[model samples]
Target: MSGRQAVPSVRGKPGWLRRLDPLTKGIWLLCTGLAVMLTLSLTAQLLWYLVVLILAGTGAGWRLKQWRLFALWAMGFGLPLLLFQWLMLPVGGDEPLWQPFGSGGPALTASALELSAALTLRSMTLFASSIVYATTTEPRDVVVALTQQLRMPDKLAYAAAVALRFVPLLLAEAEQIRRAERLRRLTPVRGVGGRLQSARRMALAIVRSALRHVQDVSTAMEAKRFGSARARTHWRRVAISPAGWLFAAASIGAAAATLVYF
Candidate 1:
């Protein structure tokens, strides 16, 4: 055998949505979130969420399995919140849909139900948009966009990039620590108090690991003279494609229309 490493094959072609610039996607996410927040009409909320669902589906290459996962997540997150909103909203007027206690007690009305549905849709729209941005945009691209396009300080941009890079690592490290503890056949903790104690142990271990990782990163950055200068050059450029600009314009326009019309 030759001393060569095999390159991994690329999967399916990246969709148009993924090809768009990270800044464009960020704009879309912001517009969608703002629209969700500004609109109280159920119809407007539904339309905004539908647009986000379409974008997410396109980004995922319209895979049925991915759509199923999105639906499952939407239902899981929205249903409980919807129920709680419907129960707690002090919306008066309209006929009571159902009175859990007595007639004199708090009652669910049509307006309350409508408002709850709108609120649930708003939450789901924001959640789905956030997932799209997080999954499609690379951390390095975010740093480039911030420093080069937005004219942000290199120190702040690099700090944001480091946070994005470290969060997943920290989570994986915590999982590994749990697995190592299990492999050692540690005493099984039971009951609420035992669970709290286990969590405390895990938290301490994670904190120590995080501190070590931070120190190593800081040392490396210092050796490289990172943030020593006011200006920096990137190895690669992140340019905004025509399609990305068009997408951003359309998203902003739709958000404006939704705000004004509904």
Candidate 2:
């Protein structure tokens, strides 16, 4: 099975974020992400991350449990990247701070730590922005906003939505495969080489399964005459309100100011 499932849906009562237009939310996320990418200071990225966290917590009502899994996943990758940066990216004139494996190993230095922190914090900022947008916005709303507000083709918007919706189903199918293997006592090899072979087999199985599912979905969509019409009508409409525009603009402006001045 894949180590993790896909995107999460909102639970319980809907919040204010649900009422806002998906396009506006998307713009806010994009602007912040760009600003975070351009900024060089760790402190600036940290501050932007805090702002995003607050919005996610207060407006989105994101609980600790929902975030815990994602945080662990982020740390799993981010920590290694951080270590790599610290060990390999330092300049020649950097002062040695500590040597983990005595004089034989590369010395940890202040410059390395600063560079690593900056890079990691920027990545974390982008992650937070994405999570907030994904958790709060519905796929249907996004499709509607894309088709109506952005002038996107109906075929493309709905296709993207279907692909996203397929993610969880694929994850579940992979998990089921793993469980069935375990039930049949089909243990793979014990050595590293054997593990790689086992992983390759599992991956191939998953790809085949996904291809089958995609074919089924494509057939179903074709049967429904999905793209026959020049224009499609939506059951729901999403339009940006005055408040949503104001909020998006403010968020983007704040990020730009911080990027330039901070």
Candidate with best lDDT:
1
TM-score attained by model 2: 0.79
Query: Where in model 1 is the C-alpha error above 4 Å?
Result: 1-13, 61-70, 163-223
Model 2 spans with C-alpha error above 4 angstroms: 1-7, 101-104, 163-213
- CA-lDDT, candidates in order: 0.76, 0.76
Clashing pairs in 1: none
Q: Which candidate number would show the highest TM-score if scored against the true structure? A: 2
- Taking every candidate in turn, the Cα RMSD to the unseen true structure, in Å, is 6.2, 3.9
**Tens-digit per-residue lDDT, 106-223, candidate 1:** 8998899999999999989887776666556667888999988999898888798777566446645666676677677667767989878877988999999899999998999999
- lDDT score at residue 113, model 1, on the 0-100 scale: 91
Q: For model 2, how does the per-residue alpha-carbon lDDT over 69-141 read when each residue is reduced to its tens digit?
A: 5576578768988898888875467778988889888889887788788898788878777767766777888
